[model samples]
Target chain A: MKIYHECLPCHLRTAVNSVMTMTEDESIISEVVEKCMQTASRFRSYDSLLEIYYDIQKVVKDAFPGMDPFSELKQNFNKLCMDSFDEYIKKINDSSDRFETALKLCLAGNSIDVMQGIKMNHDVLIKAIENALKQPLNKKVMEKLKSALQKSSNILFIGDNAGEIVFDRIFIDYINSEFNKAGHITYAVRGSAALNDVTIKDALMVGMDKSAKVITTGIDMPAAYLPYCSKEFNEAYDAADCIISKGQGNLEALLEENKNIFFLLKIKCNVIAKILDHKYKVDEVVIEAKTAS
Target chain B: MKIYHECLPCHLRTAVNSVMTMTEDESIISEVVEKCMQTASRFRSYDSLLEIYYDIQKVVKDAFPGMDPFSELKQNFNKLCMDSFDEYIKKINDSSDRFETALKLCLAGNSIDVMQGIKMNHDVLIKAIENALKQPLNKKVMEKLKSALQKSSNILFIGDNAGEIVFDRIFIDYINSEFNKAGHITYAVRGSAALNDVTIKDALMVGMDKSAKVITTGIDMPAAYLPYCSKEFNEAYDAADCIISKGQGNLEALLEENKNIFFLLKIKCNVIAKILDHKYKVDEVVIEAKTAS
Candidate 1:
């Protein structure tokens, strides 16, 4: 989706947060924020928020070269999730509908976003996971997704963040093991670091390859912009019969695409909520499907 | 006080709010916001937030010429406060310490700021007034101000908003009638409309001239930037034995000035709170005095 007027302030906030993660020097932070403001001023209404965000990220990278500010936090979050993997798996297995429980778990994991400004500690994540399990999802949509998984031969899952990948792995494993009709599953991550988004290393560390083939989108931007994707990713995207797009970033990048995709995310901002016709509010879990055109 | 890094996002928010008050056209809002961002980018760390805000206001004015977007709201708020004027005066009269009670009401009226993002309705203002009266003020500072008022021959009262001036007039009236030692009183408003601030017309409309000599700062900025003030205002400010600087804007503009000024305001943002050495939080009543150098 194109940038909304509200997105400019959000972009500035993100720019400030991103720079703050790298340094504590007031002058440097001020300089980077000023540069980001300049960058934001140059943007037109037609620009996607992801594109604008990418440019802001570039400004931060230019200031602090060779530094992934979120790396340590990402690793800490991954370990936190990894420690809870067994408990989540047991809960899913004990649930009445394992598939639905696993899906909710994946949505719960979406709350571990560093850029969302909510302090994401272990206690907060646990509370979110508990809430997500009890939170209502559209029954019709869940049934539709289940039927699609049963019928589709090829599945592609686009991952979002570091800690979220662990839950995605659990969900993918459930589908791969139980759904005989579900064929080859391909998992896609961002080519490089983008706001704690999972890369090939995170996927490998989480042992996602045990359930599905792991690949990168070859675009450093947070979202899967089709034009910038690697040839291999495009081939996989085209070949897949069912695609699971995760998080607000991917939802924004592919919201207008003519593809058979199911968006599973926790809406985190008013911009996304408005784009979704105000059917969802921030902190609500969204399970929506878009038919192939 | 100089601008903090956190103030940049606030400036953008203020810019967006300012433009939004004028028009609903998305393109125009986006254009104006972008222009404000560009203007904000040019600000130095030494610049006051009031100066940054003034420049952003200029951008909005340049877009929508000859329009005072806040005029109608200002009038509505003034009437709202005027309707409750008798009741507020009764409350002060009923209190044992009428001077302190009147001063508390003045601080309570400071909650009617349009730029603070809190919806300023009659109900909200009433609640704020009730809370402000009950909220604590530093006893030492109050004692100092009372002692200062008793000795000062020339008193300068800087007015902030339209609705607020009524309350200020009540406080000034109480002081003038009750304190025999208190001397000539002067009330200063913004020369022109500056974000719903009290102007000459508002002062006259609210009968502020009855209690004190009404004058304008001759600068349209929300804060009283001393360098840009009219010769008349500067003379009044210099001659005054006690200057009552009202609201956060004026407090920010004159926080570092070596004057016998008592800042009577409700701290509205973390920037102001931090500048005051974290002794106050947002929405707290502040009665602080800065002695002459």
Candidate 2:
């Protein structure tokens, strides 16, 4: 989605927060913030926030060389999710509809996002998962997604954050085992570190390869802006009969794509919530399908 | 006070909000926001937020010529406070210590600030006043102020916002009648419109002239930065035996000033809270005395 006036402050806040995560030095933080503002000054209303965020990441990377600001956070959350994987698996196994439960779990896992600046812990994640499960998903959208999974020969499941990838694996595994036995499932992660998003290392750590084929978008950004992504990702994106876009970032990047895409996300901010539908409140679990236009 | 990293987003948010108040045109808003960002990019660690805010306001004023973005809100809040003046007077009269009650009411009136982005109404302000009255002021600081008021030959009361100025009149009236009968009181307001802060017109609108001599600082910004203020204000500021710095803006601008200034304000943000004393909490009414260095 294109940047909104409201997104300007959010962009600056995210830039400041990312820099803060890298260093406590006031001079360095001020310098980085000033540069981010300069970058923001040039932004047009038509500019995508995700692309601009990549520029902000570049500023922070330049300030603190060879440092992934969210590295420790990514590792911590990945470990947290991995440790809780057995509990989630049991919850899915105990549910009447395993696919639905796993999908909800995946949506719940989106809360582990460091970019949102939410203080996340295992207890908080567990509580969020339980709350998400209690909230009902749109039956029509759910049924459409299930039907698509059954019919599609190839499915591309784009992953988001590190901890969330563990839950994505569960959903992918369930779909591969029960619904899409004849189809191939491909999981796409980010090429480089982008606000605790899943990388090849995180995907492997979460045992995602056991469920589906893993690949990187190679865009070195948070979102899969198709033109900039690796040829392999574009091929997978184009060849896929069905696309499962996870998290707000991916949904924002691919919102206007003329393809069969199902969006599964917890609306993290008012900007995305308004874009999807004004009636959809922030933190609401959204299951929406955007068919080829 | 010098700008904090946390203030960067706040500054951008305020600029956007102020522009939004002026015009609904998306392109106009975008253009103004971009300009504000450009101005912010040049900000150094030593830069005061109030000064940067003036530049942001300039961007907005340039975009929408001869417009006061907060005119309606300021007028509304001023009328609201004026209408409720009698009610506050009655409460003060009913209290044993009328001066202290009036002082607390003035601190509570700080909540009507538009820059804080808090939704304000009559009921909210009334409840806030009641709460402020219930909260105990620092006795030692209050005693110091009272003692200063009794002895001072010339008192300079720097006013803050439009709605809050009505409360300032009450406190000034009380001090003149009960303690500082022989002393001269000078009320200082902003030279022009700056984020709903009291201007010469607002001061007159609230009947400030009847209570004390009202003068503009000649600095168009919200804060009374002495170097930029009028010669008349500087002379009054220097000659005053005691200075009553009202609200966070005045406190911030004059925090380092070597003078007998008593800062009477509601701690608005964490930045101010830390500046005053890290132990102090946001929304706490502070009565602090700073003697000449």
Candidate 3:
């Protein structure tokens, strides 16, 4: 994907600092420390520390100009970036139904707060969708979706963070209005307390539950998800005719799965954006798959 | 301050989820939940749930139309506002050394990842900061900062989050550069990981230890420096000549303390912004203690 992370140092440092706070679990702390040691052992060949510092500089320079790179700005910049990122994340995360809204908010060329603070350019969105609609759909892909739906009756829609779920509502409404399927739609949310609230309660607040049956992804992120995701999401994924996975985090964990699913989200970061951009010229691309026949 | 948080439901749900993630001691989570309950009880007096919903909608719609009022966008907006605010804060954090690069970055508004795919905006921040900086500084407040520093030799700086601390480097540098102080500046980071990383390692990563005798805040945010922030920050707070706090979290925890401290941060959210706007006639206002006697 030719991914570029200009702020690896900051990210690495953040990871390490996060590890330090895990005094509650000595094993986890030791595990992280071991990873750090492994990284250091490989540092001779990789020069990871220097790479991190340079990446931090690159990211800092990209974000700000006319500043001496080698100065105390690193600390201030770190703090500012985290605070800004945290705040911006909130603006885009509007409960659970607005996952797509969150994705767009992330993609918008402003901090999360600015994008959230400002009104959505709905005209732009509607126009974009209209444009997408104008482009002739790949007959093969449409046929695949149709056949996939024919094979199964129930559908599971796995939500990403908060903002993007709003558009999910629109899609769900359209499906209900148009499709003559006998199955129900189960809307799934992230089970844990992430920066964005994608809980069942969040789903209810955004009224996604009212539109469709509500369920949790039944997994927490970064800690305890993989163990049960296969079982939890699998059931919803299995019974469903098709799955709709939204947002980067979902794509991160589910992109490789051999399932018939449609992924909806804005390619927010450079890494994923580049991959999707390569596949679909459009930055915010929707990829639909057909179950292996 | 007349604080209004319409996202209490989201907060409550998150608090619950966070509680589940906590170790055996669930006291902190219980406290946060209790507070949420108290807030809900208090708000029920002024408006019905529907009315409250509309009120939030009005503010969010005004800021970001087509954005669900109940979405995470509001929270992201709060982060942007806070990030914008830290720019000003870095200007006077330490009053010793000057972190020119950090200051420039803050002034330039190039602080965090904007998260756009390929279409990124470079001019938006310049305009936001230019407009923000064009406004006159609170003259009555500046006189107070100058006087307080004149009388104080030992300064204590309370850091809020990780990213903002980068900007704080500038403030610390300014303190070192401008002030002829005898005692050292003490930098306090959050003892534990409470959403943001402000641990000692984070303190060292940015070289804050070099600028001042680093200390942990010795208190957690909700609990006020439990086991993490060392007892030193408390001792320093008692003995240090001046104190500077960055970010809303710290301010919320410490604003009422009758101590000589300068609170620097952007007015995030409609509630705080409204209060600051009403009390000071500006969306961003720096609150400084009356000149040290």
Highest TM-score: give the candidate number: 2
Candidate 2 segments exceeding 4 Å error: A1-3, A25-27, A44-47, A90-101, A126-139, A173-183, A283-285, B1-6, B44-49, B93-101, B127-139, B173-183, B266-270, B281-287
Every candidate's DockQ is 0.56, 0.69, 0.01
Q: Which pairs of residues collide in model 2?
A: none
The estimated TM-scores of all candidates read: 0.87, 0.87, 0.39
Error of 3 at A183 (Å): 21
- Model 3 collision count: 75
Q: What is the C-alpha RMSD of each candidate to the true structure, in Å?
A: 3.5, 3.4, 19.7
CAPRI-style docking class of model 3 based on DockQ: incorrect
**Which of candidates 1 and 2 is the stronger one according to DockQ?**
2
lDDT of 2 by residue, A49-106 (tens): 7767777668877787777878888888888888977888899999999888988898
User: Native contact fraction of candidate 3?
Assistant: 0.00
| Candidate 2: residue A199 Cα off by (Å) | 2.3
TM-score (second chain) of model 3: 0.57
The segments of candidate 3 whose C-alpha lies over 4 angstroms from its true place after superposition are A1-293, B1-144, B163-167, B182-184, B192-196, B204-207, B220-232, B239-241, B266-293
lDDT, candidate 3, A197-246, per-residue tens: 25665565556766688777665441112334646665677676677666
Which is the winner by DockQ between candidate 1 and candidate 3? 1
Tell me the whole-model lDDT of each prediction, alpha carbons only.
Answer: 0.86, 0.84, 0.47
Window of ten residues with lowest summed lDDT in model 2 chain B: B45-54
Fnat across every predicted model, in order: 0.59, 0.85, 0.00
